[model samples]
Target: MQSIQIETEYVTLGQFLKMIDVIGSGGLAKWYLEEYQVYVNGEIEQRRGRKLKPGDQIEIPDVGKFEIIE
Candidate 1:
């Protein structure tokens, strides 16, 4: 797993995806979220606006895992 640092108190799923270079834009992130599988701390997640804060973990199949830090 890798770690990503965020400056805000929280980051939305779509924003995080783009920040990590997983997707080019929020639109692509939305489309990717709908077309692919994503998980938050081990549970399936589909919401683009899902709040991700420090200590949160996001996993994208075939891509990798990311741990959030502030």
Candidate 2:
């Protein structure tokens, strides 16, 4: 598992994905989100606008695991 430090109260899933290079761009993130299975705190999340806060864990199967940090 890896940690992603956020300087705000929350970060949108798309923004986080782009910041961490999961997707090349916002548009790609939006498109690819539907194609891939993303989990937050062990629940499948398909919304690109899903709000992720500190301590939230995101897992992308076969890709990697990441945790949000303040």
Candidate 3:
């Protein structure tokens, strides 16, 4: 599990990806999302713009898992 530091109420999957620099840009996120390489709460998430709140867990399969934190 991993934690992401944030000073906001919540973060979207797209924003989180950007904050973590996982992908180069929004375009890349979209491509990856279309490929279904992203997962949320143990399920494949094809929506790059999925909203994520504290306590939400995101799993990127071979990549890794990101646990939202306060």
Candidate 4:
């Protein structure tokens, strides 16, 4: 899994996507979420506002796996 370092207590899914270059802009988060399946902590997640903290795991098929770190 790829490690994503976060400087804050948590980051929103939309923000994370941008941090990883998954989306070019925050505005694309909604469209991306609707078009793809994002798994968070082993559960399907669709909310762009979902808060993700350190140790959280995120999986996107074809995109790869990632883990949040402090």
Error of model 4, residue 55, in angstroms: 0.8
lDDT score at residue 45, model 1, on the 0-100 scale: 92
Query: Which lDDT tens digits does candidate 2 get at residues 1-70?
Result: 9999999999999998999888998888778788999999999898889999999999999889999999
Question: Could you tell me the C-alpha RMSD of candidate 2 in Å?
Answer: 0.8
Model 1 scores worst on lDDT over the 10 consecutive residues at: 25-34
* CA deviation > 4 Å runs, candidate 1: none
Query: Which window of 10 residues has the lowest lDDT sum in candidate 4?
Result: 13-22
Residue by residue across 1-70, what tens digits does model 4's lDDT show? 9999999999999999999999999999999999999999999999999999999999999999999999
TM-scores, all candidates, are 0.94, 0.93, 0.84, 0.97
Which lDDT values do the candidates have, in the order given? 0.93, 0.92, 0.80, 0.98
Write the residue-wise lDDT of candidate 3 on 1-70 in tens digits. Answer: 8887677788878888877778787777887777757778878877777888888898886777888888
Kindly list the per-residue Cα lDDT of model 1 for residues 1-70, writing each as its tens digit.
9999999899999999999888998989778888999999999899999999999999999999999998
**Residue 57 CA error for candidate 3 (Å)?**
0.3
lDDT of 2: 0.92
Model 2: runs farther than 4 Å from truth?
A: none
Q: Residue 44 in model 1: shift from native, Å?
A: 0.7
RMSD of each candidate relative to the true structure: 0.8, 0.8, 1.4, 0.5
Clashes of 4: 0
Best by lDDT: 4
Q: How accurate is candidate 3 locally (lDDT)?
A: 0.80
